[model samples]
Target: MQIPDYMVVPSLVVVVIILLGIAFWARYKTVGPDEAMVVTGSFLGSRNVMSEEKDRKIKIVRGGGAFILPIFQQAEYLSLLSLKLDVSTPEVYTELGVPVLTDGVAIIKIGGSVEDVVTAAEQFMGKPTEALKAEAQEVLEGHLRAILGSMTVEEIYRNRDKFAQEVQAVAAKDLKKMGLQIVSFTIKDVRDKHGYLDALGKPRIATVKRDAEIAEAEAVRDARVQKAKAEQEGQKAELLRDTFIAEAEKEKVLKIASYKREQDMAKAEADQAYFIQEARSKQSVVDEQMKVELVRKDKEIELEAKEILKKERQYDAEVKKRADADRYAVEVSAEADKA
Candidate 1:
């Protein structure tokens, strides 16, 4: 078939546009936040900024877009998320010669630094998360076994955090070479076939119980002694109270007796004064009667002296009259004789 001359120019232009569109689409690729896109190919003697060596030309794009020459470069993705692994070891002998099995878990991820990403790109590029987990589990189990061999079973059981730390420290170097880092490692359990841990704790438990019983007995003895002392104090207080009451009664009786003696003395003094007053009154009456009888005897003696003087005067007059009669008779007789 012969083509038209004007149709040929337009057909050539349409073909160029289609090829350029295809090339543009193939050169531009977008990478997600959790993924790194690695591009590798011949660079026409130009240096690749993502790689240090000029012979092995490669570029890594993360969280953005990159341009790739259609035939000179290729693109691949690696996950940036963490991976979990299970760690289990068969029965292993400890430093104390005890056989034990250990079970644990670990979390790992590809490092995010430029150097670490380069390492990850060279080692784990295009590998699945399961493949990375399997690799990490094998490395961690070996380390766990080695650490267990250096420690006693009691140390492993009591300090699981320390045990995990030791395992992570030892395994971190190897995992780093494979471009992975351990976020965490934990030991879930440790067990033995012979029940050695249970047997080891028995003596300590028995000792604790025995000490508790002894403390309880000592506390009871102390309480009994305190109770006895309290009873003795109560009895002494009662005895003191009774003695005080008895002394008080005796003092009251002595006061009453002394008061009665003073009252008796006062009564005796009053009676003696009354008797002396009565005797003085009787003696005054007898003295007045004796003075009246003395006056009556003096009047009787004066009357007797007057009566005797009158009788003596009468007798002297009678004698003088008789003598006068005799003298007259004699003178008459002498006259008769003379006649």
Candidate 2:
């Protein structure tokens, strides 16, 4: 077909734009967070990798995008994500000559440093993550067997953390050469055919039971002793109260008896005084009557003596008169005879 001269320049411009867009899309590449983009082939000079080995020629891109030249550079991806390994060992004899089986789990990954990535690219660039996991698990199981042979069954069973640490420490140096790191390693279970562990716990259980019985007996004895002491104190208090009451009653009785005795004595003395006064009054009346009788007897004797004297004087006078008359008559008769 014949093309127009003015249309050829515009068509050529449109074809160039479309070719450039396709080339740009094909050259641009990106890697995610869990992927490492490895670029290998001819380079201008040493770049994007930190490896001391001159023979390894590779560039690693992680977590970003890069433009790849089509002919000189080929892009390959390596995994940066962690891998889990189930590590187990067959029955192996320990240091104590006891056979044991051990099981464990481990987490491993390719190291993140530039040197580690470069080193890993040389060894494992074409392997899958599952192939990496199998290779790491084999190394771990080998170290676990070596550790078990050096330790006794009791040491491995009782101190699992120590056993795991020893295994990790020993395996790290060998794994580093392959550009792998041990994120974590732990022992899950340990088993033996003979019953050695159960026999070890029996003595401690017997001692604990003995101590509990002794403590209970001592508590009962202490409770009984406290009850007896309380009863003794109660009895002593009652005895002291009874003694005080008896003494108070005795004092009351003695005081009442003494007061009654004093009252009887006072009454007896009053009666004696009244009787003595009455006896004195009767004696004074008897003495006055005897004096009056004595005075009347003396007056009667004086009157009788006066009457006897008057009668004696009258007898004497009559005798004198008779004598005088006789004398006169004698004288008269003598005179008549003379006449």
Candidate 3:
């Protein structure tokens, strides 16, 4: 039984076409940055993935290649990008019972673990990107309110380091719940309750005022004591100087009087000695005149006695011659011879 020749050639051509179709089915795929892999056809809802992460443990499907069951495998991309969250704090009561209003910015991004993708998938599965962003804003407000309200205003100012630490602790916990990890939670401004700072400053000002008054009083007392002591010392010095001057003047006067008295006594003694010497000289001249008068009286008495003796001698010679002449006849010759 030989078949027709046209039927045999057409059958060979149909077999080659079937083999080419099978080869084409083994290799066609597409992957992008923002999409995650999804199982299709026979591998639907399974761990098979086609992603840019080549070393990923999840099943990988290559680009531009045909998978065995593409209908059971698929990829849905999710964005991994940074976001900004504006945190606005309510006028909440602080630990010191003061109402405060605060506001700041929060920086957040996706977590590092594969659980991060798993967590994002759960919350925002069917939701849009804007809805997820709004949820992040609400979380920022809640974390700031809980952390900032626990501190007083003075403590916050003195210990901003501690405030930042507490914010990190609170944000890390709450952001995890919101499918976010905080890069930073910064407080930009804090508006305090009305008139509370002024109240605290009043007591410290009064204490400074009291100290100033005490210092002023002590200075005044020290000045008055010093002035009184200076006056007393000046008066004492003046009196001592006057007493010394008067003593010196009295001594000078006494010395002058004693010198005058000594000179007067010396003059009087010199005059008395001169008068006694003149009287002794006059008495010696009078005694010499009395001796001369006694010598002249002795000379006169001796001359009168010599004259009587001469006259008696002459009379005796004449009487003897007359008797001799009368007796001349008998003894005149003898009398003349005896004469």
Which candidate has the highest TM-score of all? 2
lDDT of 2 by residue, 156-196 (tens): 87799999999999998778888899999999988876766
How much is the lDDT of residue 254 in candidate 3? 89
TM-score of every prediction relative to native:
0.54, 0.56, 0.43
Ten-residue region with minimum lDDT total, candidate 2: 44-53
- lDDT (Cα, tens digit) per residue for candidate 3, span 233-326: 8888888888888888888888888888888888888778777777777777777776776776666667666767666677777777776666
Better of 1 and 3 by TM-score: 1
Question: After TM-score superposition, what is the CA distance of residue 262 in candidate 1 from its true location, in Å?
Answer: 64
Mark the regions of model 3 whose C-alpha exceeds 4 Å error after superposition: 1-69, 193-339
- Residue 92 lDDT in model 2? 87
Q: What is the Å distance of residue 122 in model 3 from its true position?
A: 1.2
Count: clashes, candidate 1: 0
Model 1, 1-339: lDDT tens digits are: 988997999999999999998988877899899877777776623432454565675676788987777777788888888888889999999998999999998989887765567778887777766777888889999999999999998788778899999999999999988878999999988988999977766786788889889989998998999989888988888988888988988888888888888888887877777777777776766666666666666556655655555555555555555555555555566666665
Candidate closer to the true structure by lDDT (higher is better), 1 or 2: 2
Query: Clash number for model 2?
Result: 0
Clashes of each: 0, 0, 17
